[model samples]
Target: MQFGIFSVSDITRDPVSGVTPTEAERIDAIVRIARKADEVGMDVFAIGEHHNPPFFSSSPTTLLANIAAQTERLILTTATTLITTNDPVRIAEEYAMLQHLSQGRMDLMIGRGNTAPVYPWFGQDIRQGLPLALENYNLLHRLWREDVVDWEGQFRTPLQGFTSVPRPLDDVPPFVWHGSIRTPEIAEQAAFYGNGFFANHIFWPTSHSLRLIDFYRQRFEHYGHGTKKQAVVGLGGQAYIAKRSQDAYKEFRPYFDEAPVYGHGPSLEDFSTMTPLSVGSPQEVIDKTLTFHDSFGDYQRQLFLMDHAGLPLKTVLEQLDLLGEEVIPVLRKELDARRDPESAPAPTHRGLTEAKYGDRPVRRPRPNANRGDNVTGASPYQDSDAEATYPSLT
Candidate 1:
């Protein structure tokens, strides 16, 4: 049960203050927010990807790398890395580099992002989003595990003896979580790969998320990774907290009413009842969050969206203080007590490295000399298995 915050990186006018932050201000604010999360002992900090306006996180890896340099223990990750639009080769290369740079203190979530027009901007078809997500991740999976890959697919050019440089830290790839709001195929994909499944549990009802999570758990066992209980699961939520429940409601109501994501629709009370959004005192937040475990069963990671809907930086920081000081300690104790002993633990880089290497020395890949870094040479790594061979174009 890891607790942390994720920002969608929206640069919008504060509904109450009527002041829209400049892009520069929003970017600076995000760094400060992540630092506050770390200071408060949160376990993970994640950011969302959006290529359009009202959102500023067009380059997640760059931002995360900066945060990783400053923070010691906080796990940095993405809420959604566009698997449909971004090339799998680039995804493999960039994230592997991030893994090494972060010292294995990171993981990532991939999804067919919600924005549709972004497809053409990236030279992809929105109608084929599902297939693109499926095919692209298939390649990314191999790119991480295999040192040299020979592959072809519908969405990209063929690869002959391609090796993404800067191989994963300790020879272990970052753990992946497939993020989806309603796609069963995505859930199925995650289960098939024995990867983590993350439900963006904010907009929809808990029952909706439960159905998808239940389906994922079922298929995860079908693939023989482990028991259904052992499936890695993560969820998204949002909260706005104050010392008193009335103060919370009073402060957050205006922002909620005008929020672009779910605004101009349901009332605050109605939306909160129908969705995972929490607005109240620390104890009230804890009470609502516990219901999530009660409905979805024991899970691994829980991330909250706190910086969106035009919340001011100072207010967001205060929210983090309350959450860290009042909400998390109690939730950690309660969830741990209620957890099934047989269920899986939260994903971490150190845990994955140890699982791969145990008592043995971890492999650090050192590329062999070649003609200007060509992959046509023999096994790239000096320590590669002797029998492994990569085909040459010559």
Candidate 2:
């Protein structure tokens, strides 16, 4: 199982301090957080993209590329890459470039952003968001796999023999996770392609997310991917922790009350009871998070929203330290023990590539292949004329 932190990059005032971080501070803080993730042995660090107010991550690829340059092993990813508005061509090119820069430690989630106004800002009608997501993703998939594309779509201009540059590292595209809060269509899309389905299961009850994941898993099997359990899955969560449950509640209460997303809505107690927001001791968080795997079955990734609510940078880092030292080690062991290889397997570049193209025969060197080529540095397989005089060894 992969574990990491995801930031929406909300620039809100710290309710207790009455200080809002400058945009520069927020951006710098994200850098620090990502480095901390690497230092503490986290597997991934994802940034959410938003174009509206109170959100700093309008350009996730730029930010992730910067993070990628600094970190060595962490898998840089996006919380949401807006498939509804952004052109698929741009996403394909930009992320493929990122894949080269990162050397394959990258993946992304496709989402129709939560805000409705963002559609118009991008010159798209909100009503056509679903169709736009479907069509755009279809094009984006082809852009990665095919060397040349000649196609037309409803939302974007047609392309004739268009080839995106900086082909994906390792000849494999970055894995995609379809992130949806409530949309089953998104889940279906992920299943149809045998991609990962991520339920941002923060706001809703566990039962709701279970149903969505179940639907995706079932359809994934129906599409001939594998059994339901073998379908790729990921889940989102929120947590605040302390040595004692009381300290956690006392410290995180003010932040929760003034949270930009869910503040002034539900009591902290109500929120914890009703949603997945667990503000308590580390063990409580572990207990609740384990229940998700139990209910939804083994998943590939688990991302936590820990840096939001305007917590101080120092506090957030401390939280990460505790998570690295205490939480993740245990979760890793438990999840690994429960995972059945035939049912729930980790998604990997080699696995996905083999699944997609393994059955196809390897093309042998043609008899006249590169016959006139003068390059002396060519591989023996490409030395077709030399092969006639001397049989080549495998």
Candidate 3:
């Protein structure tokens, strides 16, 4: 299992300090946070996308690309890449650029985000969110895999001989994980493509997430990717830790009560009991996290929400220290011991490239001299189909 942290990128006032971090402060703090995760041996660092206030991460690729330049081993990804709203062409182009810049140290998790108003901001409709997600991803998947795409879709203008440039690093597209909270269609989509399914397991009970995961596993195997145990899965969670259990609760309670996500609703204790929110000592956190495997079975990735609800950067860094030093080490050992031998490993760039190419030379596309337009060159229909259409591989 891979363990790491993801931020929703909320810039809220600290309940204890009664001061909100400036956008500049929050942005800088996030970079520091990501660096600290890498320093502490965490495996991944992800940031969410939100186009509205109380959140700062509208452009996740730019932020992730910056972090990619700064960190060595940590895999940078998005907690939620809005597949419904963003143009699939742009996603294919931008993320492919990021893949090149990071040297394949990145992947993306796509979801129809929770915010409703984000639809019209990008000239989409919430009612069509499901189909939008499905259609857009269909196009994106083709964009990355095919050298020249001739396509038309319900949501976007038709494409004729379009190529998403900077072709995926090493001719292998970045791995994709379809993230969903309650939608089974998304799970079905992930399973159909043999892609990873990520359940945002933060808000709901373990049993609820279990149903979605189990369905995904069954469908994944039904689609003949592999056995259920071999299906790729990921779960989200939240945690806060202190030397003592009481100290953990006392420090985190105020923020929990004020948090816009779950605040002014369930008591922190009830929330923790019902969901995957763990607020306790290191041992307590480890104990709670172990139960996730018990409930969800063998999974690949585990990401926690630690920087939201106005937690100060200093405090958040302290939590990461505890997580890296005290919590994850133990969890890694225990989970490794318990994991099914037949289960899949966490997705990685090298793994995908190797899976695609094996010992053969990797393909490097070299386009013909510019023909002033893409329709006549490097397109599948070039020269009335008398010759090969794809760019010649060097």
Q: Please count the clashing residue pairs in each candidate, in the order shown.
A: 0, 0, 0
lDDT of each: 0.92, 0.84, 0.91
Span of 10 residues, lowest total lDDT, candidate 3: 377-386
* For model 2, the run of ten residues with the poorest summed lDDT: 375-384
Please give the distance, in angstroms, between residue 125's alpha carbon in candidate 2 and its true position after superposition.
1.0
Report the lDDT tens digits of candidate 1 across residue range 60-121: 99999999999988999999899999999998999998898899889999989867899999
Best-fitting candidate, measured by TM-score?
A: 1
Clashing pairs in 1: none
RMSD of each: 1.6, 6.6, 3.3
The lDDT of model 3 is 0.91
Candidate that would win on lDDT: 1
TM-score of 2: 0.89
Higher-ranked by TM-score: 1 or 3: 1
TM-score of each model, in listed order: 0.97, 0.89, 0.96
Model 3 C-alpha lDDT per residue in residues 1-394, reported as the tens digit of each score? 8889999999999999999999999999999999999999999999999999989999999999999999999999998899999999999999999999999999999999867888998999999999999999999999999877889989999998777887898889888999987889999999999999999889998888889889999999999999999999998989999999999999999999999888999999999999999999999999999999889899999998999989999999999999989999999999999988999989999888888899998776665555554445444322223464555559
